[model samples]
Target: MNILVTGGAGFIGSHLCDLLLLQGHSITVVDNLLLGRKENISHLLNRDDFSFMKEDLLNLPVLKHIFENGRFDMVYHLAANSDIQKGSKDPGVDYDLTFNTTFNVLQCMKEYDVKKLFFASTSAIYGETCDRLTENYGPLRPVSNYGAGKLASEAFISAFSSAYHIQTWIARFPNVVGERFTHGVIYDFIHKLQANPEILTVLGNGEQIKPYLYVKDLVEGIQFICEKACERFNVYNLGSDSRTKVKEIAAMIIEEMGLDARIEYTGGDRGWVGDVPEFKYDLSKINELGWCAKHDSNASVRLAIQKALGK
Candidate 1:
């Protein structure tokens, strides 16, 4: 199969590309290097089966040109603004990079007669819900521009699927961590400690708990759901079974880095605006499909720290 992955040079997407190539599929990666680093997919540039395009998904004409030449069978949409606060600062970023990218991708796919797509969705679409979030659980209100944009993308995906017979797999992921991480709590903590090892300042009150899924585990879920779940539209919550607190993550990072830093709280329920301080994913749907995350949140945190620290 020939696969086209938007944002395939980024953290999770690059991992997806690796798995695809290992499975004997030829892949063409289109990434503008916004959140994606060239280094992430640099290792694949030399291969015959792998190709990388330094292009933005928001540019529809160029995307269309690529689609015409590629003859792609499957499309994986992962391009989006990774930062909530950054998008909150400028809603246009989320609009162009997150939502518009999906819209444009769907348009190109429709024009090119591509039938299958895999979307990298997020749990943030659930908002600050108290209940364990299921694929069917919704009032689907996202507080942040980032989540709002992704939710909007999912809506278009559903529309495109129904209006045109496109098969789609949507995985709502938790906070993913591991190697090649561009930004997130663990990455931020590592950089902060490197700057000042004496004091590690935490964003919120340190009680925010959310599941952390390893990136590898996530891509495996993608592969599993991609192969097994046959439907016009399939959605699943891909995450760890257990939850870990932010303070606990901080403590683990502190211990792993051998830092004597004092953990300081900024005193808030969440790290920033548009942040969901607490949430849980009900993986019952995927579990019933015979797919589950091997690492719990705590183990994911520690393993991610080790990979980040290169220990």
Candidate 2:
């Protein structure tokens, strides 16, 4: 199969590309390199089954050209403004980057007669719900613009699927952590502690907990769903079964890095203004589909810390 991965140079996207390539599939990567690093996909440049284009999906002309030339069988749309904290600051940017680009991708798919689309959605769309989040969660009340954009994109994809007969799969991921991670709690802690090993300043109180999934496990789950699932519009929560606190993550990083860092709380309810304080995912659907996450949140944090520290 010939696959096109948008944002294929990013942390998750690159890992997806690696897995796809290993499966003997030809892949064309489309990345703007705004947040994605070239080095992430550089290792695959020489391979005969891999190709890359350094352009954003927001640019219609470039996207059209890629679509016309590549003629992809399946598209994995992982490109978007994924930062919740940053999205809270400038929502307009998030809307443009996510909704607009997704619209363009759907347009290209419609025109080119593409078969399937795999969208990367998020748990942020659920907001602050008390119950464990399921695929059929009621009324998406996204606190941040990032979640709103993802939900909006999902709606567009659903509409496209209904009108144009495009098969789609949506994966709502939790906090993804692993190797080559550019940003997030683990990366932030590593950088902060590296700068000042004596003291680690946490963003909020230690009580906040959320599910975390290793990148390897995430990629495997995606592969399983794409291959085994037959639903026209399927939504699954890709997250670890366990949850870990932010302070616990910091402590794990400090211990893993062998640093004598003192944890300092900033005294806040959430990590950021629009951050989701706590949430749990009911992964019964994915688990029923015979895909289970191997690493828990704490284990993922420790391993990610080791990978980030080059240990």
TM values, all candidates: 0.99, 0.98
Give candidate 2's root-mean-square deviation (CA, Å): 0.9
Q: What C-alpha lDDT values do all the predictions have?
A: 0.94, 0.90
The stretch of ten residues in a row with the least summed lDDT in candidate 2 is 82-91
How much is 147 displaced in model 2, in angstroms? 0.4
Per-model tally of clashing residue pairs: 0, 0
Best by lDDT: 1
lDDT of 1: 0.94
Q: Every model's Cα RMSD, please?
A: 0.6, 0.9
lDDT of 2 by residue, 206-255 (tens): 78999999999999899999988998888899988899999889888888
lDDT for residue 129 in candidate 2, whole number 0-100: 78
User: Which residue pairs clash within candidate 2?
Assistant: none
Model 1: residues with Cα > 4 Å off, grouped in runs:
none
